[model samples]
Target: MKRVVALAALAAALANSARADSATSQDLSKGYAKFSEQGGQALYANVCQACHMADGKGAAGAGRYPSLVADPKLEVSGYAVALVVNGQGAMPPVGRMMDDAQVAAVVNYVRTHFGNRFTDAVTKDDVKAARP
Candidate 1:
């Protein structure tokens, strides 16, 4: 009986561990942690840099990721917001995994970085409006 009880406890522990791992995997699969608390720069490095590159110049060869550096497309905040939220060809709608605040943060970060000097900020409200 003790052996059976020990086996049951071990099984329960394994099940709990599996549940935790599954949750972590789901969060990563969604482009990043759901509404992750990380700041814009961190988010960019963790998520966007894989495709867009660390310098934001983007990459090619395997795929054609556009350069964000001094791109005129970022002049308008709304356009960037929409693209991030809805995505364009090749780029997935990564913003779907982010909340409005997270979306705005990463957008604002990109707009301000990579040779971009756009002063205007993308508010969370703008992100919300851009969704769907």
Candidate 2:
């Protein structure tokens, strides 16, 4: 009877852990949608800050987040839109969590800010079309 009770307790603990993980993931995803109207800064903080870092310099380790500052990829608005919408490598697909306008705002902000001088402006239509 003790063995059976111990097994049940272990199973319960595992289930709770899984639930917590799922909730954390959902909260992170929701952060992308938070303050969609507030434009790039808010969106970046809520969604990208965890991985890309607040400075946009990204991290250097086993899996790099790729610095957004002065990145050649930002030279093309479409490229940035596609990356945000479809994601790449270790990056998760965040387009679905954000509306087209939000995507455009964040993409444009990233391209223009972070020591970047890219003049191209990403439109909502561009983000919508880039969705995979």
Candidate 3:
């Protein structure tokens, strides 16, 4: 009887730990959903690939193509959203082609898919705030 009770207790503890871990992961992102990530990927495919290349290596010498992945403030969607909207160097202002939601999606995509540390996904409001 003692052994059975001990085993049950251990199992309960393990289950609780697993649930806590899941909650922690979702909470870490502050309610950012996986669906938003997909939107971000679509935006990147549509708007960014031409010059920066699909992998974001960019071209040599000319530097007309900027590195969209792992760039200045790449880990933060807010900073990236600002640059995408305002434009910099050779990058044309993307706000002309995309709205706030689209901008957030792209920024979130690059920041997350490129292995950067943007924990929470970007939102339309984030893009609006980043606007110059």
lDDT of 3 by residue, 12-129 (tens): 8986776578675653212222222236766676567766778976777744566656665686566677778888777888654677777877777787765466668878887777
Over the stretch 1-132, how does candidate 1's per-residue lDDT look in tens digits?
999999999988997786578676754432234545456887798778989999998878976888999999999999998988898897888888788988899989999999998989989999988889
lDDT accuracy of residue 9 in candidate 3: 100
Q: What digit string (tens of lDDT, one per residue) describes model 2 on residues 1-132?
A: 999999999988996776578675654332323333348887888877878899999998876778888888788788888888888887877766788899998888888889988876888888878877
Residue pairs with colliding backbones in model 3 are: 40-105
Alpha-carbon local distance difference test for all models: 0.84, 0.79, 0.68
Q: Any runs in candidate 1 off by more than 4 Å, and if so which? A: 1-37
Query: What is the Å distance of residue 21 in model 2 from its true position?
Result: 26
Pairs of residues clashing in candidate 2: none
Give RMSD to native, each candidate.
Answer: 8.5, 10.6, 14.9
* Model 2 / residue 92 / CA error / Å: 0.4
TM-score of each: 0.73, 0.70, 0.62
* Top-TM-score structure, candidate number: 1
Query: What C-alpha lDDT, on a 0 to 100 scale, does residue 26 get in candidate 2?
Result: 55
lDDT of 2: 0.79
Better model by TM-score, 1 or 3? 1
